[model samples]
Target: MDIEDTPVLDNHMHLDPIEGQNIDAVEDFESVGGTHLLVLNKPSWHLFDPASDEATFEEVFELTIEAAADASEVLPGRAWPVLGVHPGLISQLVDEGYTAAQARDIMQAGLDVAAEYVADGPALAIKSGRPHYDVSEDVWEASNAVMRHAFDLASEVGCAVQLHTEGSEDLTEITEWAQDEGLPPEQVVKHYSGGRLAGPIKSVIAEKDELEIAAELDEPFLMETDFIDDPDRPGAVLGPKTVPRRVRWMLEEGWEDAVRRAHVETPARVYGIDTEATLGR
Candidate 1:
């Protein structure tokens, strides 16, 4: 059997459009044995200026929707959409002289648009989180406020929320915030999560941390490459094929149940997907 036919899901990855890449991003990810992908929609930081106003937010809204659709087009039901304003971009807006109020308004509008897409179709989760340990209190608060908006929208739409935050943060506080927003802890997922932090509702475990995390936690967590879809940074955080490669390693290690949980079962449970139908295993 093809190693990829073993079934694996990449829970966190960026698969947006790029001008210079030679291969199709979706095809590349799938060619490596990826069965399902959760596509995050955000402009590459190095490629575009961060937005600060309503007009800019309108453009961002369209960009996010289009990127999600782009991935879905690649593999039909295989690519799940995760839409939200970039929290780092939120912080950047505030730092670039956009008033806190303006930033909040823009982010709120972006979340509104994202929520609409989720409510409509082809979208499954909301991704809104920022690095918490390295920002000023004011910037932190602004970022947190925007994140609250994301959680609120997730609650309203009944979709999972995928977090992108520092690994060492207090997940307890994050879970509490999710609770306050009326979102169950299980609906809150920490992306790039592992090591030294209490688990959230779910987490997207990095490839290197997979073994350590699988040993430490019993909860069903997802895996990711956090692929930026950048030609200049292929395999930057990790290549698109890393998740499948990790799955192969898991199989070699006799982690059959772990593979099923992270790749098939947990994703279905968290994102409301039909993994059995997708993988036919």
Candidate 2:
């Protein structure tokens, strides 16, 4: 499998249900003649956020898993799943001022709504039999541990890890830690390099520092446009058809081919996905 043989490959994307968008990207990929598509997992419901009670982390994880399973079945080996906690969720869950009650409510609501579509679990052994609080310094460490476990689970299930390495020292540190723990650098794919705007990662692209890091570590890197329609973050949305526009910018800097090729070739090798298979000569 190779790039020339395939119609197109979308390296970074969220396939699980979001807000209320019914057109999961996997289906959309098939319609567009995309030979191979990789979908990243959002953290489970219970762990969604301490502020909202939308659903449980376990529940959302299940939904994502089911969606991956369904996409695999529907596309018959054309779609693959990249499981991990997205960074946006991590940021929300860890922000200092975010109230625990608010987090719980928001997460609960999402979890409840997704209940019918997914199951929850891999529930942690809460020491005091209570939800983890946001403000506690220990909470950040604890959440990292939980996400690390999720990463292990994803690997066990033969899925790639699609991690959002946005504006956080924690994420960068975790990536380094994962490498130390024997996870190959190629196994992790960094997404949404542009949307991030804080922490150490905030100015990665602006500084053009990440490329050196990526080359030095030999990791497969990806840049993305998070075309999310969030009323809470009204300025975040870049409309639904923003991919091409983003691609154009990447091309202007002579990065479009380099990034896309790295994304397709490297991940294909890591996940054992045959690129030629999708090309359908």
| Top TM-score hit | 1
lDDT of each: 0.70, 0.41
TM-score each candidate. Answer: 0.87, 0.53
136-187 per-residue lDDT for model 1 (tens digits): 7666777788888888899999998888787764588887898899888778
In model 1, what is the error at residue 195, expressed in angstroms? 5.3
Native-referenced Cα lDDT, model 2: 0.41
Off by over 4 Å in 1: 1-6, 20-23, 44-47, 54-77
* TM-score computed on alpha carbons, candidate 1: 0.87
Q: Model 2: per-residue lDDT, tens digit, 57-116?
A: 445555555555665554523544443333334346547455444443343334233322
Best by lDDT: 1
